[model samples]
Target chain A: MANVIPPRSGTAFTLARGQRLTVIDPCGEQVADLVAFRADDIDEVISSGRTIDYASRIFLTTGDPLYSNRSNVLLEIVEDTVGRHDFLLTPCSADTFRIIYGDKEPHRGCFGNLAHALKPYGIPPDRIPVAFNVFMNVEVDGSSGAIAVRPPLSRAGDRIVFEAKLDLIIGLTACSALQSNNHAFKPIHYEISS
Target chain B: MANVIPPRSGTAFTLARGQRLTVIDPCGEQVADLVAFRADDIDEVISSGRTIDYASRIFLTTGDPLYSNRSNVLLEIVEDTVGRHDFLLTPCSADTFRIIYGDKEPHRGCFGNLAHALKPYGIPPDRIPVAFNVFMNVEVDGSSGAIAVRPPLSRAGDRIVFEAKLDLIIGLTACSALQSNNHAFKPIHYEISS
Candidate 1:
């Protein structure tokens, strides 16, 4: 789609039913680690549950459909490589690492490494929820609705891919280097297979 | 919570009965035109099939508890306007006005100004769906799960207010310079009253 670009040492595909997977990032600076499950019972995804409220932009190109929390249907992109991705926002937390490294260091972030990577599969770090900080840049102020979190149109090795119709356990946050308002601290690399 | 802040010419506070409103935007470019309806039938807004899904930032900020989609308890955020707000991701069709200006002109987006500002009531515009780009900054490539789309961390005025708990008819796109990849053309200004 973007000149058949798909080879950076990390690629894979599959999304049969109702097919459609697209993800493009060209050189927007990679930061993908999506997780899915349920295609044939990988461990139930589509689990935003409670009818799902909102938040999904930390990057996930195309029509953006990988809902769960019990909503089901874990894949639907079709194709893309830089068309634009940033699914809501994530990649920095713990009160944004104590407001950008304050609260006297020793602060564990990225949701404390996603609770030590799901604490060897017992899950519980307050349930690991707030994630998805895709391309960075956040704005919201229509007459005092303030929200100016920017710094990331993407730069450096950018990438985006999708095609997992269902069956996902995707969980990635390879965005270390505690940054604020957007990039200054770098280190983002990702890869996934079918 | 951040010391009362909501006056961009929008008011209607009565979230009393159990106050708990919290709508911040840190820096995501404000866009909060909320509603809940039912403070004794102020036209009803308890269920638009359950709203507030700013994609997935989770709703009712002040401790959280908006629930709907059939979960119930429509309001909570008692008081908020200390930051970001802007959730209305889709509403610019007709090929996005010929792909953001040049398929001619006059596309009017945001579902034609929210169906001409609610067409004096009767509402229509296919019920309008697909919105919730609050704090925009999409990126989905945790190893090929593509979903790029970018731009927007707020730039202009900057606000965030939400205190109704119920009584809604919200609809605002206000800005649609369009170009896909998550709005980056220009034109933003939205407001809502009690």
Candidate 2:
């Protein structure tokens, strides 16, 4: 099945083990926050820390394995059109908006969108996990240990693919924040297959 | 209800929001790896990174809020007897045993025990999250940034209490690893109350 996740919106679906899920940026420069859990036990989830530790690298590319906290493989990158993706940053939230944009208004960021999408599956708004930022460009300054978000390098129609190692409940959210007038976020396309 | 989790064994239970779960070191030298997830969604789970970032500290104590990856409050430390817990280390696993102990023999560490306990709840063995090591004395050397395991400071009947912020499925495992000849592991007691 294929679906389009609108800008600032979210969607959820189940991917059986051995199945594949692909996220596409129809228009370049968009970021998608993705979260996944074991279908049988929601508590066992994808761990960014474990993934980084297991891969021995911070950025993920084709052939990298995403691991859970228990050191179990969750997903494997089977295909990638864009070579850069971030596994070091946490998903943006309302609290992040308050800090970065100085906006006191309720801005449901990727965290809120994910919670809203997974609510019917029994996930509460506050229980959303940190995510894998697909198509996002983040770089670390080695000497100072500072991280900076840069404009994505992916072109329109670029996509990344992952093969599930277990039955997984996956959530995807199109980011809502904008870096500047030159950069604007767009919707993401999803495709899942057995 | 109260239950005694034997040394080298594990247990699982569900706690509704607003309820409390207390972990007690019955014999004073035990370490319990505690992992929690949102009862409904399972995918939104405890994240050591988020908890540390949110609390702004690596060591946990009373009044500290444990946050999930989405920055949601999972549990609050309402009571503590020893006042020290670790949120920086991942649960010990078979692979870790190979690295630390150089033993090729099959060893069931906290990860295996937690997976075994949570199996009945549909959680597989690999989904265990990084745990909060309760009653475990792990000290880090500031100069070298090296962590060393030591005997627990808790006395018999010493415990820590967490008030759940959401419905949670918690798994607790009595550590099977031994520090040395003088340091031995013991059973852990669990108590849940509204």
Candidate 3:
């Protein structure tokens, strides 16, 4: 008889082909923070260039390679149906809450989650940098140069694989509740294993 | 008679209604460390859900009130484009640089700029919280329940205005670049005046 598996929530990790990590939306909807970093001296890591080269395309699916400031490979996409991803935009701050979310000051985005996760690694919030908008699509109008935010073109049960070039500390967040946007906000499943 | 004024690279202003403070391109835009506190007492402030209500949104404009972690209105959005913004994703940090840029960290885009600006004010980078995604459209997707990172529908030269709720310390940077994951990567202009 075949073995039975229970329902899985959140990410399922499976590392291979260099170093692969996948973050599942579990619920088959929504895009969350799945950031990566190159490790240096355990708790030390760095970002790539401040800007993402994808113009407005957000989302990280198959074949995506996250570059670092050092020009070394950080994270590479091995498998992903969640096409473009968002790696831009820093986590929220007080002013952000005030400007965008009037009267709301505290909300946890990718940056907050990363800060918390790295706490065990002796990293604090002050150390969090701008994240790559993985598996998210942010497009710019080539003609007018306008920015357009859209939903993930990927579907449910999709996965993005990345091979880590060097030792790295990847921060994953199953994006919290984003009820003010559009269809892109859905429960997404993730997995990462070695 | 012709009234000749000094030449300015970008627009200069005290920040009025319908005026945008800046445009953030995940590809190259970056805002640094910022400190928000009760304008009354700049000496002491709070952190993590003290001054700001994480559940609510705080609407701001030029010279409007901006509360701190201690729930004291601190700074204000001297300029903005998107009327309502998000306070969740703030500026860059050390960890942020590591995650996005990786081991080969870019010299810029870190919270260093924020800290540098705060140094003169006797504040530290730790005091700054996440920032607002001004001009950037981050709507909650109903079907996916995720905050979609979309480009702002606003046209070039469009504006979002806010008032300083309180006297606050803010550090900003026009992201030099984002090679991580493409979103909105462009030169952002910031202006401040009394």
Highest TM-score against the true fold, candidate = 2
Better of 1 and 2 by DockQ: 2
Off by over 4 Å in 1: A1-22, A27-66, A69-73, A76-134, A137-148, A166-194, B1-76, B79-165, B168-194
Candidate 2 local lDDT, B1-194, one digit each (tens): 56898877788899999999999888887888889988887766787756653443557888988877556889999999997666545666776566567778947777788888888788766456567888767654432223566777888899999999999999898887775112576788989999
Top DockQ model: 2
What is candidate 3's lDDT per residue for A1-194, written digit by digit as tens? Answer: 11111121122122233655655544454555554544554323334222232211233346656655333456766776666665534444444445545646455544555667766755556555555544555553322223444665545555566677777766655554342123434554444455
Against the hidden reference, what TM-scores do the models get?
A: 0.26, 0.60, 0.47
lDDT of 3 by residue, B1-194 (tens): 11111111111122332333333322222222223443344443323222223323222234444445334444445655445443434344455545645746544343555556556666554444444444434454322323444445545445443444444444444432242113434444444433
Query: Considering only N, C-alpha and C atoms within 3 Å, which residue pairs clash in candidate 2?
Result: A42-B42, A42-B43, A43-B42
Instruction: Compose the digit string of candidate 1's lDDT tens values, residues A1-194.
Output: 23222221122233455443333343455344343444454334432211122223333455555554333456655554444443434334444444445556644544456556555554444334323444444443323323344455666555545556554444454444334324433444443443
By summed lDDT, the worst window of 10 consecutive residues in model 1 chain B runs over B3-12
- By DockQ, the candidates rank as 2, 3, 1
lDDT of 2 by residue, A20-129 (tens): 99999888888988888888877677776456534545677889888776567889999999887766446677876675667879578777788888987886664455
Identify the leading candidate in terms of lDDT: 2
Ranking by lDDT: 2, 3, 1
True contacts kept of each: 0.03, 0.05, 0.00
Q: Model 1 over residues B1-194: C-alpha lDDT tens digits? A: 23222321122234544343443433244333343334443333332212332223422234434433223455544444332332324444443455335467556544455556555555444334444333443333333333333454554544444444444444434334343324333333333333
